[model samples]
Target: MPFVLYAPVKDGLHDPSIAKQVTAFLSKLFQDDTTPGLHIEPINNAVDPKVRTGRVTQMYRAVLFKLVSDGVPHYVFTGVWPHDKAIEVASKAVLKMNPVNGLPELIMASEVDLTPVVERVARVPVASVAAEFPFLEYKSPGLTLAGLTEELGLDPDVAEHAWVATSEDEVMELAGKLGGWRGEALLELAVGATIADVRISLGMDTAPTVEAEAVEDEQLVSAMRTPTAQMQFAWLEDQEELRRVIEGGDLAAWRIFLHPEQRKYVEAAYGGSFRLSGGAGTGKTVVLLHRARMLAKRNPQARILLTTYTRNLADGMKRSLRDLDPSLVLADAPGKPGIYVAGVDQAASQVLGSASRDELAAAVEAVLGIGGNRATSRTSSAQKAWRDAIESVGGDLGPELRSPTFFDAEYDSVVLAQHITTLDEFLRVRRPGRGVALGRLQRQAVWEVIRSYRSSAAVAGAVDFGEVCAIAAQLAASGPIADHVLVDEGQDLTPPRWQFLRAVVPEGPDDLFVAEDSQQRIYGQRVVLGRHGIKIVGRSRRLTLNYRTTAQVLRFATSVLAGENFVDLDDEATDDTGYRSARSGPVPIRVATGSITEELDRAAAQLAEWLAAGAARDGIGILVRDQRMVERVARGLEDRDVRVRQVSKSAATGKDPQLMTMHRAKGMEFTHVLIFGANADLLPAAYLLKDLPEEERADLLQRERSLFYVAATRARDELVVMWEGKASDFLDAFTAKDHVR
Candidate 1:
């Protein structure tokens, strides 16, 4: 037999000395027909065909199962086990190739009897959930192998075995045990992926799908090793590398495998524009990055711009790029199309001139008639000048519709965003994004305040932050800068920023690809792409399988925003219809701290439980409303010797429990998340509602809801929502009764 070692077997090589022994024995056998003490004999037919057991140590035995690829036979060491358990492991081992990615993978065949479980399930065929739980669609009684096959891209044999022997719970069990993309595929199905989506994600329908045919034992033995992702057994080419992986115990490879549909988003070419919208943890960013690497590989000479809303996220994206493909060189990472990953501001500055926040603040002060900038407020907050200016009118504009917060959002997000400078232009501008209805007369009155605010800025020779984006967009439209542009967190960018992004990239096939989840848009910056000349009308797709967060956590997180309609980048209503999670965990723990002492004690106790339960110090995360809470909780955890990794301006991924402001937890996931100090005062955030009219306060609360959703979804397994004194009204509303009163 041609000797080979699979990743699974290498991963289980916990002891370096024992691994070296296996290498020595294998090398000796390869040299001749046998080693001094090594004995190889075919296992019984009740287990796998032509399976041989090699003694690794006095107590441990490893299996060498013969699998054929491309009509050649190869002996692969699937895994090692205790000598007594070798027979059991071999009896249930699966040596199969994934039909989706057409990659090979190993799965433990089930040894448990299914007859009892199937009988129990027969009592209750299928328990249907409410309409709110749209994705809970599996009807258990008749859920057949064929039904699951259409969704999981499994081989007929694999699907038949699974359906005949599995229960709903077993689906999740096999998913986790399968490992790699096979596990991911099964997990997606458990979360309610449609057959079409599963097909697309697995790349099963990408082109002509290849289904490996069964090869004879003799034919398989001569076949060369073909190992790629589909959870296949990755064969090492270097002896040193193999030795290091087996002996050094550093076999954690950072390879990202995408679903076929996700692959389609990365590889397909739209005739013009394309956009992808999905809930958080649906792998949108993964698709965006893969698309970037895909384009880079397609043409080494191409330059691609991958931009996000903030520089922090751009930096995060850069780190992910390196992890996904270390060979691809960007401005920082060394290797071709040579990607330029940065915030939208980096590209915006090229067109609008690079003015620091201090400079922008000075200009804003001059425009707002406040003299040449002495305020601590930064340039990004310049949009506040308009609100302060309008509210300066006091009761003159009347109380009925004179809410400064409402007018500010209307003018900043819609008016200035629309680039309307005159009263006539404002009158004719579309107000689709405006939440409150405004008649012409109400708008006329609002315009008077805007007109006065404008005259002050015009006379003082100043400009606000909004004007910067407007000017940048105008400048960019003059000439496109890059051949292709990919945007992450597109939902957070304002209309003007979207326009600028559109202007920077000339329209063409694969020119622009934006991935966003409007439900996670904490900034409340909504846009209709068509308004910015970036049309994604019929070229948009939505992903529904969530890879992070447990099913219980997803249910709770999504429930926070239930019944509310959200708009996608194209301004069409985005439906999270089939969005679901496969992994199950405890429903989030909501601890109401009756007193401040109870609050602190409760949080500390929860952290203790997680640490004791064997969660990685780095895997557990604690999130709070703002930096002040971050300091308080982080120090508290430190007092207990719990290492805390803080996410901030100078954030770095560290091997310790993470503590961060809920805002900083965006696009991040952890095994355990303790949302600390969810008190009423802390939640709406003193800053969120302190300045807004009571009538306009709902929008702020909604923004807080989105922020809460983002933070809650960060937990992959455990979630604890803790509070002191009266809980936030949001917390109450979220856990409200499901049935109609």
Candidate 2:
């Protein structure tokens, strides 16, 4: 008969030192030839032949099936598994089996300490043994066998056999003898014997089980009788206590509520794909960072892929990750498994190579009727001449070309028209190819156009950054690079981008985590991850806690998003540990005159005051609607002797005034915020009045709402919302309630 040794320890399997010792002990037993047919399987970290991880439940289920199928009298080790449900299931499976012909003798080897099992079972100690293990230290010296039996409430005679093992060899010998008890008999014995009884029988004396500890911690003589009254009264008292703690922080409470729910969700959803959709200031990036950290801890071998629409955001995320864990190696992490942070086109181009880049540029230039070498003065003149010839050939340049808009203001109409014509031609080239090859070329052309518009260095750098996603999607959908694709900002993706992501990932719901919120999309675009067969596994969870902003800041900002799907924490009654509030900060919102000069003066004055009050210059931000506005503000602030950092989409460097467009300010926090150009055409016009359908118009409105949400929440202690001309239409509805003077 195979014997079973039940060694329960206080620590869990996560302890590397303890786990190693357990593995060593098991290895010794399995290696002994006398222990025939004894197979010791350490399930933790043991890879499944099919799956890559040894996930506890899967292994236990396999073990039960094998026990029933083979009917071998083998010895199985069970100590490292964590979840109680898995243990319960395994125990019940053993009870159901007929011991004579089915199932093996299970030996649960643990550090001679039984505090963990005692805590789990809420029982007392019954036995003790003097065995030296490097990982454990026994605190209760000179503990007697009689004392153990009395503490556990176990019958002394039945518990006598528990202390039979004096050394490692004897423990193994004893484990083999008790391995094969029948189902009903084992159940009866387990129920009759408390953890104390088992410990005394196993030769441990001073083990304090769960029941004993509970008795020692709480007095048994409490006068309260009714359970409901005790529970209700206690809950009310706890709430009152929590309210006091929250109120003490005053305006800084919201940041405290930000992490708990986020951590819980990430823990539950670890190693799986799911979407995280929320409005701006809902802690999406915070959750993503925390999720990355947790995933790093759980699956150390898995690589992490972090990509964003812009190069700046990607760089920012990489910096933030480094801040969170300095030792993290981004290059070797999982899912290709390390950190590859770049814009979508940059990533795709890296994979697709120069041939694709050249083809795309050629297509873009051919369609635009521009010279191939537009970067050169000669090539630029040639393009101008070619555009004039096209116009001479009756190519009616549209009204948009003749009349300048925000984007066309800096360039001549003929030049703009040439680029437009080129884009149209490139689209036409890929229209017939339609499948994988066409998609790749179309994607390449999109990026090529953007690159050409943005830079003179390469065709890929001339087009606008937005077009990069379109091209990457094409390559992902139908090219060799379509094996595994991960996308961030799923909500901001356009329809074509969604199609591209769908075409790349493997066919299943479990393969993707589409995290996007319709309300938080500030780009005014519509793309559904689920519509394209991406499996959305669970309900969208709301992360309403504001970790970056204080209670006052959260209140003012959340008021704007009020009727939308959001969770508003009473930030005034919460606490965010380790974050300090500005000592003499003004109420976050400020309304000033529409004049650019007047606004700049007031902004400069406020900034000087903040700096004098000890706010770090680096922590202050001046946000605007466009690059032109940024330059205007920078010049105004610099003239006043206030050093400024200008962070423009195009400029890419510098540390004066931190002049940033509203979109780039997402996922960043500032101690003080000064928002300029809240005027109608500038604030909402960039997105609101485009030549798109009514549905698209509504989508833009939602995006605008989210954009404002982002701007308002960026302020940790102070916020100022100012405008120059007619106020934005977005503020009209809110302005009625004295929100703006």
Candidate 3:
């Protein structure tokens, strides 16, 4: 009855069988530590007298450290290992309390030998060593060894080891060797985090006040309770919770352990709407899922709506929410009093689906200035409608204004965005982010085109999804649908979608929460949230710690947007800076072949090699530019006797090396990725760029780059990019770096 058990979420619990055994052991231990089946025994000659080993199975044992806090026994389950190895680890490892931060840290008695570094340094000339020493600058001022150890609480020995690192890669390797807070601290410092920044990121700045001279166990237990320490250590609440944590293994670790920076946003109480922005894999969506659950738990009756750009991603978030807490009640409709998950359009449809015919007609009149039932209308694509309007009524317009791209954008960016109905209103509205200027005569021509499109849509009773969203916003104004709305991939939402979301949820405390990354904006153009009545001024935060991709892959992915600029929802210039990955892997490999056939052959060989090296077939992806390229590459792989599947709407459900378009690759990650058709013409996709104005053309290029960035970052461990003839101009960013393989 006096037991408090904690477990460190380590990386080795991937085996389902071992996970089950560990789960069973934890259940028995938590229920009663005295259970003989646990075989909980003290390790002989352990460095720390508290160290012990408990039997998890016949062959495996759980290494634990037992401490007493206020007359209660507390155990820390370090990891699961084989019988002999577990004993060895328990005897040599000690859970030490960090003196400066007053937090507990896991340490090993054995230290990495610097003999290899010394020998390598000895072989190099003094000048060469000075040039190659990655951390030589650390010897100066605030970044010195003493500064890291005495000030930041990094283990002195680990700091000394990193001081001798010859390259950045060596420092990363050393960090891996000295795992735990020390490794993370070193990694943070190496990635340009200042000493104070490291403290803040580690949550030490906000940690509970600790008595340095307090009883050792009491201090340890207190440290274990800090948000920073919980990133690696957590207590088991019940057998079911323990089972979820262990059985979910490394893949599900995000649900259990959250970075201190992430935890702040997930639990913070906002007075109004807040925006969370980050790069790919920075855990924005993770924060949304956690925050949704936290909000639901706080008020069981609160109607929380969780929505995203596409139905597929919304569906995925629903599953993730369920995984985080199966007890959560998910609602089938946005108006229901529970956490509702659906795509933005789907949410709009749900609202409109229940509206009366008169309400629907009024909503349509409000949006398009036309009275009709949009549900019964023959829906047409926005592009086709724009083309038909341009060809029929935009004849007098200049060659520049005659483009469907320009007209379609004008309608979204100015017309629907501002709810402009009449030509006079359209001419008066300010057009922000519409690069090309329009004179009075040109504006009149554009209005004529818009009028033509509106007339045709009215006669045919056709409405685009954008109009539906606008209509939903109008209908919801009379009665809001949700008490709270959480949006993911907010960057991809059109202005109409933003208005609909704003209308669905009343403007108040915790009304709207958005998770987006402008750098991953693959669908819609830049939208200023304030223009849509959503104010996040001084209420926005960014995440820079990428938890998904490796540092090398992150570097490669970010380079694609090197010169491009982006703006946030606030309309201020935003940048992709301060991001750093905790892990490091091989630099991406890029190859240029003579023809499409040769490129396919190279991709096939690499895919085959990964499969041969034991990578799971389902864990590898072949991403191409378009669906056509997806089919083509799939056929190429099939021709080579390589079994493959083409996936859309969702990630591959089965094995056999799936292929998909770059757009489909968003919100997914793979252990290995092969971008098979990255040629210059195919990437910018000549068809999309032809006959476009220079500024509009440049905008398309940015979207293309973002698409490539998404595909490149989807790779978790390794990435291989192949092209026929000349590679895409995006590859030029790769050649500038030493990572070109």
Candidate 2 error regions (>4 Å): 1-212, 215-258, 269-272, 296-303, 332-336, 354-487, 507-510, 537-539, 558-586, 649-657, 686-698, 735-741
Q: Report the C-alpha lDDT of model 3 over 72-172, residue by residue, as the tens digit.
A: 77888878777887777778887878878767787643443546655664464444544644463442335777777887887766677677765555667
Question: What are the per-residue Cα lDDT tens digits for candidate 1 across 1-741?
Answer: 344545454234435557787666556544443555666666676345656777777887776676545544456666667786776666666555444444454555442343444465445434345222212245233344665555455666545434533334555545554555556666655555655555566544432334355444433332213211423444543344345445544323323334545756777888887889999888898888878988888887776889888777888889888766666768532111489898876556544443455564553343232344222212544456556666665445555455555665676677766666666877788787566666677667778788776666655555554555555565555566677889999888877677777777788888889998888888754677887788888999998877787777887788778766777787788887667665666778788878766776777787778889999888888899989888887777667666778878876867877889888888777889988888888877876565565656666777788898899999988888888878877666556343211
The TM-score between candidate 2 and the true structure equals 0.50
The candidate 1 region of ten consecutive residues with least summed lDDT is 219-228
The alpha-carbon deviation from the true structure for residue 303 of candidate 3, after best TM-score superposition, in angstroms, is 1.0
Residues 304-328 of candidate 2 have per-residue lDDT tens digits of: 4555555677677677666555556
Sort every candidate by lDDT, greatest first: 3, 1, 2
Candidate number of the best lDDT = 3
Question: Could you give the C-alpha RMSD of every candidate to the true structure, in order shown?
Answer: 6.7, 21.4, 2.5
Candidate 3 stretches with Cα past 4 Å from truth are: 1-6, 9-14, 70-72, 109-141, 208-213, 376-380, 650-652, 736-741
Candidate 2: deviation at residue 48, Å? Answer: 48
List ranges where model 1 is wrong by over 4 Å.
Answer: 1-92, 96-105, 109-171, 178-254, 332-337, 350-377, 380-388, 391-395, 399-408, 437-465, 632-646, 651-656, 690-698, 732-741
Give the backbone clash total of model 1: 21
Q: Between candidates 2 and 3, which one is better according to TM-score? A: 3
